[model samples]
Target: MTPPRNVHARAALLMLGSTLGFGLMAIFIRLASKDIPTWEVAFFRNAFGFLSLLPMLALPALRQPRPAAAFAASVRTDQLPRYVIRTAIGIASMFCGFWAIAHLPLAQAISLAYSSPIFVTIAAILMLGERVRARRWTAVALGFVGVLVIVRPWSHAFSLGSLVAVAAAVLSALVAIQIKQLSQTDKADTIVFWTYALWVPMSLLPSLFVWRWPAGIEWLWLAATGLMGTVGQLLWTRALKLGDVSALTPISFMQLPVVTLAGWLLFGESVDGATLLGAGIILGSTFYIAHREAKLAREQRSKAPSEAVEPGS
Candidate 1:
């Protein structure tokens, strides 16, 4: 079925914006890495990102009589344990991801990072006890083939950097599942607040070991990393809400090209045939998996009673 033209256009634009934001984020991370440790970069990113959300949290207060209390109420949550778990997994992913971007070819790191959905499929089956048929299993297998193509451990193409990128994807998949559970009980705002609130300190420990004040433009790059990441994330969430996952998932791959171009232009990085091929394979496999999931979901919704369900829920 065709989505409404205007709706799909809006979603496409949002996804493109998100792609640019994230591409710039990788660029900024590399720039910051020249002078600052990746761990400190993570710490500053969280601290600035957490601060960036204050105005957003305050928006809710404007609607209520007691602004201060309303703001406090918005931030209050009973889900500290869940937030801690989620933040731990997320911080680990963040660390691994930063390390990869700082250490690996930008295209390779970003391409492997995109394999999170593959891991999510397996994680869902294992952790959530969700049933999957042979088809998704095949798609998942194909996704691994893409990973191997990129890594190619038998050849010089392989390195710990490649493996670290894949590990980041794996932890990211777990974070996705954890967020799914938390979303059931926590408002999106509450979850966002605590994740960053806790991430600030969680990422701080390792950072202190290497802490040196960011000098001159190192400060600018560090701050831009936080802004770009946060804005990209918000746009990504918005785009998914507006468009079909099957469609938006492919659009998100535009990030790879954006980063690939930036990597070559800014850092003089070279991309090889394997990285391009592996990235394409991963993109194809993921798009197919998303298409299949959407089709089955539609079929299931049709079979159930005639109650209103969210279009993309």
Candidate 2:
């Protein structure tokens, strides 16, 4: 059955809020990073995000063991090795992401962040041994062109900030691939819990090297980082459950503009033409790639006619 119209509307609204939450979370990360070490900011974000996930554990049915699955449905997962690998890379990505937010122009940083999917496509082909066609190859090429447009490492256009953001994107793409591997065996909640749980300890070790107390309202900024990150994820999860991924994914790009506006109004940062043009090019390419993937998935489903995968599963 088709989702009700109201359901679609609600999904749109939820996705909108989710984007806003994350956009603001980036702002908060920048604010918090002004006074705190990047690693420390990441740790507190993980620490508080994990705290917010506690209420989810209270849902009785979520923890039930799946007989066929290798892992249970609770906070614990049997995928220790996988979790360890993912956590390490994810923390590195978070560190880069937060640092970029603090150092780069918000628009430029956000633009570079969207380059993850381009890297994802490359990683999928190399690591997953997946075959690719000319269309996706072309899209990936175009995506790289867009990245170069933004990075402009040779001239005054992009430098360390762009490089850091790109590193974050690359690491993030690797994490995405790892998550795909884990999702083949573990439940989403178990993966999420383990991610944040493992991140707290993993992220803490490095943070100690640069740790200092949060001065004044810096504590509030840190708190907002955790809270908004968690809220955005929760809202995003719900929105995806209620709407089509193809319909919702584009709404996420709204985050760039929201964050850019915040950067201007709050920090007096001005965005330049290269960033916007580069961002548009990158977005267009990634959007096409996503559209193709979704279409291919739909075609596969039509061919096999299996039971529909449950939301978030």
Candidate 3:
């Protein structure tokens, strides 16, 4: 089904803006890597991002006023443990992704990370019990083939950096799954806030092993990393609010090209044809999966009973 015309337009614009910010974020991560350790880089990024969201949280509109009975009934305090687990998983994903960015060619790293949606589709089938049609399965198979093209396992031995990039994508898929689970009971802001709250400690742990003070110019890079992340998150929040996620998801594929161009022009790295080809395949598969899922969800909603059933019955 087509989304509303306004929603479609908003999704296109918002996702485009968010993706450009994400691409710039990749460039900042590379620049910061020159003098700062990846862990510290992750730490500052999370720290400044956390700091930046404070004002938004203070806004009256974002804070819902609750009656004592309604608050107790709607809020599930028992879900705290689940929130912590999701936060830990997210932090680990962040660490691995940052490490990959520091070590691999930026375009290659971004392309590999783009494989997360393929993993996400698989995870949805296995863990969420979501049904997948044959075409999506074929797309998933083709997507992995594309990954192998980028990795070229048969050519030479695997490069650890490239492998790390693949690992980042896989871990990010897991993180996305965890977030999906958490979203059943938690608001998006709550989940995102807890992620950084948990990140500071987990990210700081790695710094103990390889901490390095930033040089004068390095400070600028680190600050940009943090600031860009906060800006990206804000754009994402607004984007998702303005448009349905399924509509916006496909537009995010633009990040690969944007990041690739930034890598070449700013860092003098080449954007190879093979990486672009693989990214195209992966992104195509992901978009198909998202489109299918949206169709399934709409069908399910249309089938719901006129009167809602009790939670257990």
lDDT of 1 by residue, 1-313 (tens): 6678999999999998998888898889988998789899999989887777777777879889999898788878888888898999899999999999999999999999989988988888788777777788888889999999999999976797789999999999999999988888878778888898899999999899999998899989988998888888888888988888888888888889888888999899999999899998898888888897777677777866766443221
What are the per-residue Cα lDDT tens digits for candidate 2 across 205-258?
999999998988998999899989999998998998898777887998999999
Q: Tens-digit lDDT track for model 3 on 133-233?
A: 67888878988977887887877735767887888788788888888888877777666667766777877887878988888888888778877787777
User: What would you estimate as the lDDT of candidate 3?
Assistant: 0.76
* lDDT comparing candidate 1 with the true structure: 0.87
Per candidate, the number of residue pairs that clash is: 0, 0, 0
Candidate 3 global TM-score: 0.88
Superposition error at 118 for model 3 (Å): 1.1
- Least lDDT summed over 10 consecutive residues: which range in candidate 2? 304-313
Candidate 2: Cα lDDT at 124: 85
On TM-score, the leading prediction is 1
Tell how far residue 294 is off in model 3, in angstroms. 1.4
lDDT of 2: 0.86
What TM-score, computed on C-alpha atoms, does each candidate reach? 0.94, 0.91, 0.88
